[model samples]
Target chain A: MTRFFSLLILLAVSLPAHAAFNIFATVPEWGALAQEVGGDKVSVYTATHGLQDPHRIEAKPSLIARARTAQLVVATGADLEIGWLPLVVRESGNAAIQFGRPGYFEAARFVSMLEIPPVLDRTLGDVHAAGNPHIQTDPRNLLKVGEALARRMVELDPANATAYVANYQAFAERLRTALVRWEKQAAPLRGVPVLVQHKAFPYLQNWLGLKETGTLEPKPGLEPTSSWLAGIVAQQTAQPARMVLRAAYQHAAPSLWIAERTGIPVVVLPFTIGGTPEATNLFSLYDDTINRLLRAL
Target chain B: MRTTLTAALAAVLCFAPSADAANDAALAEIRAQVKQMKESYEQRIAALESRLADAEKTAAKAEATAVQVATAPPPAAPAAAMSAFNPEISVILQGQYKNMKDIPERGITGFWPANGHSHGDDHSAEQRGFSIDHSELVFTAGIDPYWRGNLTLGIQDNEVEVEEAWFQSLAIGHGLGLKGGRFRSGIGYLNDKHPHAWDFADAPLMYQVLFGSHASYTQDGAQLKWVAPSKLFVEIGLEAGRGSTYPGTDENANGANAGAAYVKFGGDVGVANSWLAGLSYLQTSAKDREAEFEDVNGLAAQGLFDGTTKTWIADFVWKWAPDGNPSDRNFKLQGEYFRRTEKGELDCLDEEGVGNACDPAMSGATVLSNYDTRQSGWYLQGVYQFTPNWRAGLRYDRLDSGRRDFGVNANNLLVADYRPQRATVMADYSWSEFARMRLQYAQDRSMQGVTDNQVTLQYIMSMGSHGAHKF
Candidate 1:
């Protein structure tokens, strides 16, 4: 053990400085976006995977060590990570990622948010004060954030400014063209009544023009009481939703339970990048989401 | 309306151009008056719209502010949430109901007896009844950009004692961290953790023998740690403490009487398995540490030992989880071995009226004896989390009295080599991240002559903001 530690210390001391700028993203989508925008000039480290919930995490020291060396920190922000991110960044002691710095980029700030509560109360249940932070569900919002992130990259790494601008323009154009095609293809899904697992899919519902009738989780983080589930079942009996929708990452029990009772097919969408095998990147993320919804129908 | 007026004006122009120029001037004045009225109304409407927009913006900002405050649990200071300087406060509550065949006479085998701060006085001996255990209130916040301060006050039966108070540097660069004031020493695996964080209702037998009932290596001290920049987690830490707790006393820590150093490494075995191992060394000096013993007359006497103490510890932990997610199911196996050696002088004195024997240097009647002893202990524990909210664990502990030698004394006392062992089984359920209840059963043999069959039920609850547990 002594010999191993000694060698490790020597290697750490003797290693050359890395040429790649290191970026630490709070979630996977931003990590994917960073990879797309910064092809060879950066290395990205995502703090969370698709399956793990991002609200809370075990903040290990190795994560702090990684943050300590990070040049930029891209996060969903708007308190989506309010429980863990502030503590991690504070512990990292990295001045570059401190709030108000150029390297501190919040993707939510670049996009218009939803669900800004009209009145503040604990009764609201796990609501984000800065508005709903699950903005990546909407492809339009991701494009806006992508543009902002590319500009931030240029500000942080001025030498790669032209490359970043070109990358952003190309990504923006591709997304716009895809957006028109997706909207036209998804016209059939318009006005389709859908029951949701949680409010995580409201932006997606809005994008696809689906009418969300109710949610399995009446309040965030609260288990569905049988009484609450009964009310949804009654509604489904009257109006009869075409499908029950949920994110691939969420537990399927509640959605499956509702589907079994109501005979509504349950559809699992890729909520973010890499949520499913085919949802590998930004474009594929939406493609798989639409395909899954159509398959369920 | 405008076209008719224009045609009327055109007919009048054809018929009345020969009429008076004053009539045309009067018509122009009327048109100017109508135009001015319209412009005034348009400006007033624009002003009203601007005011409405500003009101909406202000309302939205207010809602955001209110919602942010509502997100956190309400604090004593209503303005505390927005105030950047408000300290983060957290409270931990622990309660337990214990049942046992017998509670021993408050002393650990092969070690010193209770000295006020023992398991006997607080929750240990209070069996067959519900007792509020050592709960704590913690306050922490950043002192400045460069340093963060923390204080934990232990609360037990209306008595509040300072458990730990320290300040740590945030920007010490080069994988280096520096801590000052009093903090838990980086010792064996479980030494630094509080009882609230323990897997069982009580500590292991090995910890009871090595330290007091509270298995803490905390003291007034300073520590420096370094993390190697390697794929594997490698860390080295060293501490210098005022030896004012168990294993040493306040009297012994006149200077830097305690010191420790440790090296640890951890890495993943596969996608779902990981392991960590560490080696630690500690040395301290104690003056007049007291324990109970039988004199030649078979009466209880106080034995004060002054000596140099040295200890070595090795710890290992292995964890496995399905799909790298511990929420559904996981297994953890951890073990630690400790060996301690001491060279000291024991001064035995009668209770109440010791006849100046309390001061060994002042009286010849003081039974001054020189002794050298070696003792070792080890424990292994395994826990399996069957679901997100339920877990079961089993632990075994062994202690060995390695070697003992005593000098010639007036009372003529000697202790035999003996190995003591204990086993414990526990199950716990967490209602949420903030609350947990545990049921435990143990067969302890830490006492020389008695076997203790102990059962305990415990609940630990945390309220307010708390930092994440370290891995």
Candidate 2:
């Protein structure tokens, strides 16, 4: 019996702990940021990939197990992950990463949020009262969130504080230099009236100063009906938009149909890191977004 | 007047030169004082200008640092802090219209009637026409940094019952969790899930046979679960409780009458597929358990059982969604099988005199001292979500009577050599995450020689703060 217990202990202690700090990010964007900020001091596990909608991903058992040993959890918390994050944390039983703890970090609180609703109601079709949670579309928000995430990492793993701070400084320097170039290249997109597939691009519009003409979705989350598309087609005869924009994860059919009818160009932006082949990192994500919009223009 | 004025001007001119000597000296003194004051004022102005320049330089440097990085720590969003102390509450309103035969005394064919089946008083069985099902009121909240509490009340018609009220530990390290109170035992896959979360409108024939009127095996208990610190999901749980529900009767005993242990393993096959499988065991003892069954002559008889029951359950589930985004489409397949054994003494209280209802030698009650039986049941189901709002499911259930040994009163009740089975199909549509409507049909052969065709239409709407569901 003693030998059996010793073997059990051996098995339990033999779990794979590859990194000094383990972080679970809810999306690829935050995962990329955590990697850049923590360098080799941390290991990140992204819950959802670029092809999946972060709002609707399942809380699979694998995710729960991943969360059980996580040292920190980074999320875009403007009610974006309200559906699944709470359940994951409760099931994980990891008190370090629960809400209000030092190890839990929300990115949205660092930057100024846009599109805050005046009324809170589900009749508006899944409106986030806290504002749009897709803040990663703009490079400025990424820098801000990265700075805060670095501080959180240092707080959790103080032994690696100097390494984390140094890495964040290097990353912030590169991002700031790239931001100036992206803004200048995207100057032509300013004041360009554009149609969007959904209300997912308010921060992008705010950053690039793109004018939103209409949305393909009838409401925030509802799919567009044929009649709504017909009405948009009729309106385009009088006043036409320069382009229709959509994210890489969205279905191409809606924006493609609109582009076909209006004869406008369809611009598919890699909304986050690893969303497309070209968008492999934080800087490339913005580069690919600007290149697409400029192509469309 | 001109001659007088010229004379006065000449006299004043004569005195002007004499007064100019004194005035010149006074003017020189006033000029010296003015120059001293001007020098002091210029010195102060130069000092103030330098200080302003220094302040501007520091301000500019601070602004530059702010532009380079976020200097101030980000404050948490005020909206995330809920201050009302109001627990998360959700109310589920459910109603169903069932169309089926009106068989008053409904019982599974081969399996012995469990508790709450006497005269068909089982609440698990649905009504004939339109009826309000068990609507649920759930409240959950964190008690403190270390614990959380949950309460769920099940209401039907004018009756209200506490279905689950438990408190769970929050800060137990080592991937360990503790829960205590009245809760549904986590023995099988579907046992812990509420009715609204079920794909079909009714329980399977296997569950109906084993648990009788109860939708799940519930007990007032305490549970301890541990999750292994591995990449692959592995969990082990143990439970002890007062077995006062189905299969075990409340005898006002001091110690625990039931205990359970389970272990689950799961992992992701790929980005699209995930699966979990588990095995569980439960044991309980009962005293004077009452049940109603038909004798060999087809007459209703009452039986009292006193003994121990042991059950083993194995469950498995697989879920698939393309790229792990279920909003577009998804599919789930689940199944569970249970084998049970009972060893006890069965005493027949009523001995009908007609035909060969008990031994002719017995009087009022017939006692079978060494009664031993073994029974098993299994169910499999598959649900496919073809669209974001529509889903369809099909399920099949079967039960085996297995072996039976009646010691003395063998002539009173003959062992049934039959297998009860059922097949069900359902389609449901959801307007949103909160509301769903389902239509289901089942060909039930649970009762002996009765192939009852059942159709049901049900609606479920959840309002208020509904939390996320478990896997």
Candidate 3:
């Protein structure tokens, strides 16, 4: 029995106590930012891949077990992950990383939000009460989130504070320059009329100064009714749009269906890092997004 | 005015000084009034210009928004914080339509103890046709930084029972967790979940034989679980429960009536497959447990049995989903095997006292018989989610009691070699995550010479806040 217990102890002692801390991010954008800001000071893991919808991924046990040992959890709060993240954190049983704890970081908390609902009801078809949670679509919001993440990493792993700060500063400077280049390169997209599959591109459109003509899904998260699709088709026929915009991770059928009938080109933008091959990091995410819009134009 | 001064050269000498002073003062008053008017007019002009500029800016914004709705500016709405620290509440309503050739005389096999059945009424299955299968009310919340709590109430007919109410420790470090209260034991994969969460409309026959119609493995107890830090998922759990319900009665002066221990390990295969395997052991001491059975003469016979029961179980599950997203296509295969052994004495006497040592005999005598029996059962099921919102599954259940002894029938015990087997097929469609409809057909051979053909239609609807499912 004593020997068996010793074996059990050996198994329990297998927890990784490496020099780098583990950071668990709920989405790809947060993971990319963590990697950029933390550099080698932390190892980052993304809970949901780019192809999967962040709102609908399953709270798998593998994720919970990984979260159990996470030194920090980065998520885009404002109830974006209301469907799964709460239970994942609760089941992780790690008090240090629960909501309102030092190890928990929400990117949306650092940036201003959009599409806030005055009155919230489920009848509105998945309206986020706090605001639209797709804040990372705008490059400016990414910079703000990166700064906050840098401070959090310092607090969690103070030994690497200097490295984290240096990395964050370098990344922030590069992002600032990229934002200017993107605005200049995407000038032709300004005031351009386009149709979107869903209302998820508010922040992206806001920055690019694009005008929204119609939406495939009349209501968020709800399949478009026949009548609503008819209405969009008729409306777009009366006033033609330049293109149909959709994210690389979004379903292609909706945008393609409209594009086929109206002859409007469809543009699939890389909404986050890893969403497309060209969008390999935070800086490239904007580059690929603007290039896709220009191609469609 | 100069002519007036000339009106009287002589009078002007005295009046000219006063008139000139009055004229100067009047001029000063006129100048001040003119300055005030000019200032007011300039302020008005400035206000009008600013208003015009604001109107132009707003029109430009509206036009910009109208150009491309793809990036259309959102209508300004004040944001209201909806975050609440209050406990999340959810209700699950399950209703089913069932048709069976005949109702079983007993809920479980004869060897199974009586307490496994419902406490208040033994005829819970009497209702036929359309019936409210169950109504479950659930509440979950974090009590504080150090703990969390969950309460589930199951309401059936006019009776309400506290199905589960437990508090779990959250501050325990090193992947250790502790839970205490009345809860379902973590012995098997399906045992820890409520009926509404089940893939099929009803429990498998093996689960019914080992537990009951409703899961009877739940009791007032404390459990401790440890998650190993291995690359793969590995966990060990132990539970101590008051076995007052089933094969074991309330504890005596000796100690608690029951004890249980289990260990589970899980790992992933490549990127699309995952599997879990577990082993469990349970032991309980019964003071006086009663169950009804058929005698050798085919007559109803009820008796009290006292013994120590031991059960061992092994379970395995494997799931494959392309891209790890079950939304499209997935397949799950699960199986569990259990063996139970009971040894003690049974009293078949219809007497005034409840004692296992006493037996029934003619001519004013009593005899006690050895209640030694060994039984084993197993179930295997496979479910395929061929498409979104659609799933089909098939399950097989079997049990064998090949060995049996009653001490040469010393107490006139009626022992027979009885085996039961069943096969079930089910298909379900879910409109959303909160609503589901299921159709199931089952052929049950639970009784010795009976094959019950049963069909059921079930709907489970959940509303309000609900937690995500555990992997």
Candidate DockQ values, in order, are: 0.08, 0.24, 0.10
Residue B417, model 2: Cα distance from true site in angstroms:
2.2
RMSD of each: 20.1, 23.2, 22.7
Better of 1 and 2 by TM-score: 2
Q: After superposition, how far is residue B443 of candidate 2 from its true place, in Å?
A: 1.5
Q: Which of the two, 1 or 3, has more lDDT?
A: 3
Off by over 4 Å in 2: A1-19, A227-239, B1-83, B115-125, B351-363
Q: What is candidate 3's CAPRI-style docking category based on DockQ?
A: incorrect
Residues A127-172, model 3: lDDT tens digits: 8876889988888777668877877886677566667767876786
The TM-score of candidate 1 is 0.80
Give per-residue CA lDDT, model 1, range B200-290, as digits (tens). Answer: 8888777777777567688587766666645566777667677777788776323466777788787666546767789988877778787
Better structure of 1 and 3 per DockQ:
3
- Chain B TM-scores across candidates: 0.78, 0.81, 0.78
Off by over 4 Å in 3: A1-18, A213-219, A222-235, A238-246, A250-255, B1-83, B104-126, B252-255, B351-367, B408-416
Each prediction's whole-model lDDT (CA) = 0.73, 0.79, 0.73
| Model 3 lDDT, residue A269, Cα | 80
lDDT per residue (tens digit) for residues A79-168 in model 1: 787666776665554556766678789998877667776665435556776677888887877766886787688667765665666676
- Estimate the TM-score of every prediction: 0.80, 0.86, 0.82
